[model samples]
Target: MVLAAASHALSYFQAVVIGLLQGVTELFPISSLGHSVVIPKLLGWDSLAKAQSQSESFYLAFLVALHVGTAIALLVYFRKEWYGIIGGFFTSIAKRRIETPDERLAWLLVVATIPAGITGLLLEHELRTVFAKPLAAAVFLMVNGLMLLAGDRYRRRAEVRELVRTHASTESETEVGRRLDTLDFKESVAVGVAQIGALFAGISRSGITMIAGLARGLDHEDAARFSFLLATPIIFGAGLIKLPDLFGHLGNGVRGQSLVGAIAAAVAAYVAVRFLMSFFETRTLWPFGIYCLAFGGLCTLLFI
Candidate 1:
């Protein structure tokens, strides 16, 4: 059965609310999908959450448009990186060798995207069918929180151990620098594989990837950058795949609402990424983890 569109139709208010929520939560380590599902239920807009009709098609399209907005924001914000990747891609083809850091990083991103692409191709529909229940989403959100917390603890301990070793030696702190561009094939592949977890409704794409990066000893800032960069292809691809489905519903006012929602989503996502990049320079993911845990637990208690 198809899901009911938000409030039986894609109202402007619903569009903006869901758009803002998607933009903010999409990158905040909490599950945007979980919020998309739970928020409607909590607001007593159960009709909005039901998979019932062609209107549901519009809603899904609207969500995809929000993702497209988010992807666009990432692209705009990271245009420099994209430029390098593009140039390096061509250069590698022409030269028959990857020589520059950009070229190598481009290849790394390709390696990083492969696993997720494969995973989505193989399991997206299955997972969506099996785990679309709000209770399951809530439960997985808690799991996501626990994963974040555990990852943080593990990284902190690793950092402490590294600090001790550094202090014991003659090297200065400034001398211990990370080169994110120098990630080997193995590390890149690992990060890519870790991205598979995000297919779960409550699992976060950026959060899981950053955790994987931390495991590979990247600092938070660099890890966040890497995660955001890697997110572009997947997010954009998902949106594109859903765009055709939206066309049939465009005449029903879905088009205008989608435009507004996409704009709101883009602006919000740009602001969020800007803040998060600076924030992660010094802050840990603990706060977001705690929030997810509390929110998820509350959702579980109330809904399950």
Candidate 2:
């Protein structure tokens, strides 16, 4: 399906380009696939011209390549976690043991992935339409920027409330801060539900979901860890569902483009995964979100 098409279509240079996009955008608050759609749409003179009369389908296969590449990146980055999860699931089943934190976290990821899974099932076609037009994706990228800003704002507000609670209990003027893990499952579910919106809007899956985690009081690192882990199952599931049709409409240059794009995506996505986790430890998401805004706004001004 999509994986096969993506595998078949890849070329050397295109792989690097699309892989870079997939890797970078996937980690940053800006959507990688969103950029994959928008960049070509707005900057592609010939393609844009063709769309004046009707949309072309040139990028669909590219999109599939990026997704497959991303899926591979995710699997590789999180392999250790997956091993623990798989082992824990089987151990729990055979021995009726749920002692390990990994088992519980594994269950949590399952719960978290459900909202997006259901949402995608219901709205996938409509969501695909959004990517068919580059300008629209650019506009949505702007909206994603707002989402990040709003997420940071809300998270800070929640922190304030937590501080008040902390102060009421503590007698000392200065104390170490509580980590994000102190938050409850309710917060995780809230974040999971928020992820559903990403179905229609060009919202970053990581951005919205991470915001949801932050809203529930998870620290940036923990929130991000959970975000990447939660994302895999859903994205992988979507790829599986689309596997069939990837062959039917095979684009003109799919084979070569896919090869280049996939390699790029793999290398880039690998770097992005490594880079972003480190970045989340110290930096705020404001910068990434604002970047999305600038790009989105630029696309709008230039095109419309």
Q: Could you say which candidate leads in TM-score?
A: 1
The TM-score values for the models, in the order shown, are 0.89, 0.81
Which candidate leads in lDDT?
Answer: 1
For candidate 2, write residues 67-186 as lDDT tens digits.
777778888998998899878767777878666767667667766777778878887767666453566777888999998998877767856458435632212232222344344456
Give the runs in model 2 whose Cα sits over 4 Å from its true position.
Answer: 1-15, 45-58, 95-97, 130-132, 158-184, 249-253
TM-score (C-alpha, index-matched) for candidate 2 = 0.81
Clashing pairs in 1: 2-51, 2-52, 2-53, 3-50, 3-51, 3-52, 4-50, 4-52
Cα lDDT, model 2, residue 235: 70
> How would you encode candidate 1's per-residue C-alpha lDDT over 135-189 as one tens digit per residue?
7778888989998998877766656347434432222233232457757788899
User: Candidate 2's C-alpha lDDT?
Assistant: 0.67
